[model samples]
Each structure stands twice: as C-alpha cells, then as structure tokens.
Target: MCSLCGVLGGRGHWTDTSSHPEAFTHVEQPTRRRERQERTRLVNTVLDHYGLSLSDWAGSSYVLKTKTGQTALVENLTELWANAEQLTKHDFDPLDEALIDSLAAKAAR
Candidate 1:
C-alpha cells in the first residue's frame, strides 16, 4: 500500500514525483517507442497524399523527398506534421490542391 493513492505497487511507484510536483501521480507518459510509431504514422499519412515518404536520415531525424526531387528536412515527425498542416492552409506548390485539402480536412477530424 502507498501513502498518496492508497494503491499497491503499480503505476505510482514508477515515477519520481519529486521532479514533477504539478503533474498528477497517475499521469502516464508515452513510451519512446510508442511516440516514434505515432510520429511515423502521422508523417506517412500526410506525405502519402503527395506520393512522398519518410526515411530515417540520422538518429532522431527524417527526410521527406517530394516527387520533384526536392527534399524537406523533418527534424521530427511532429514538426513535419505541423508544417504540413500550416502549409496546406496556404497555397503550397508541389503539393496537389486536392491532396492538401483532403489532408487538412482529415487533420481537422
């Protein structure tokens, strides 16, 4: 039994509560592998519209090459997805308008 939650040895015992005073005791952090998978999924979905794909560049970085042979350095999948969302809202070339609209609409959902 624990003092804070009155539960047995489970989730609460894993975190160092002293470091995150404001964080809830039961709040769970996403694992690195899970985050990577999610990022890959989002990046793939966004890039697939343009017939592009994400390839690992260096550790923790990715490269998205467009059909026109232009390359975009995605520091991380989150950043890549965000840039796509922002650019699609405007008139971004190289990306088909229909695809942009479709991806943007999907993101909204």
Candidate 2:
C-alpha cells in the first residue's frame, strides 16, 4: 500500500494509547502528540546504538533512517525493530545485556 493510504487507514497499535481506547477521548490532542514525541525520543536512544534514528512522521507513523540515507516508514513499534535491522544490517535485541547496560548508564547521567 502507498504510504499516504497506509497512514490514513492504519489501525491504532496497542502502544498508541496511554489508557483504554474509550478513555482516550478525554485526552487532549497536544497531550497525545507529546506522548508520541516522548516515545520517539526513547526509541532513538536504542536506535542510536545501531547508527540509525527515528522521527515522528506527521503524528501518524515513524520515519526510521540510517546515517547513509536509507529510510523506512515504520507504522508502529511492532515494525520498528525489523526495519531498524534491515536498514542497518544489524540485529537488535531489546533484552541484550549490553544494550540494557548502556541505557542504564545513560539514565544515570
């Protein structure tokens, strides 16, 4: 599917909501946007280890890109690791001890 169509028709992933879907109505739009921004920032911390980065794309999807200009539009976190590995030719393990240590060190700063 085309990127535009995918963005328009995509279903919300479980991670997209801070609370129950029904309660999402009580959240303000800016608050939702900020949540997404925070998620992107946190994801970037991991992606940086692989020499890649992610950015929020139009508040609907994520743009994952490599240092040499390769890019992919990630629809959600479910697709993030796969695309990051493909783009960087490196495996990403969320539970890898080294990654956990790096994150812990960064958090300590």
Highest TM-score: which candidate?
Answer: 2
TM-score, one value per model: 0.43, 0.79
lDDT of 2 by residue, 39-86 (tens): 999999988877889999998778999999999998788788877877
Error of 1 at 2 (Å): 44
- What is residue 46's positional error in candidate 1, in angstroms? 1.6
Name the top lDDT candidate: 2
Runs in model 1 deviating more than 4 A are: 1-27, 77-109
lDDT, candidate 1, at 90: 39
Report model 2's TM-score to 2 decimal places: 0.79
lDDT of 1 by residue, 31-99 (tens): 545555666677677677656677766534566666656566655434455445443443334467887
- Model 1, C-alpha of 19: deviation from truth (Å): 14
Each candidate: how many clashes? 0, 0
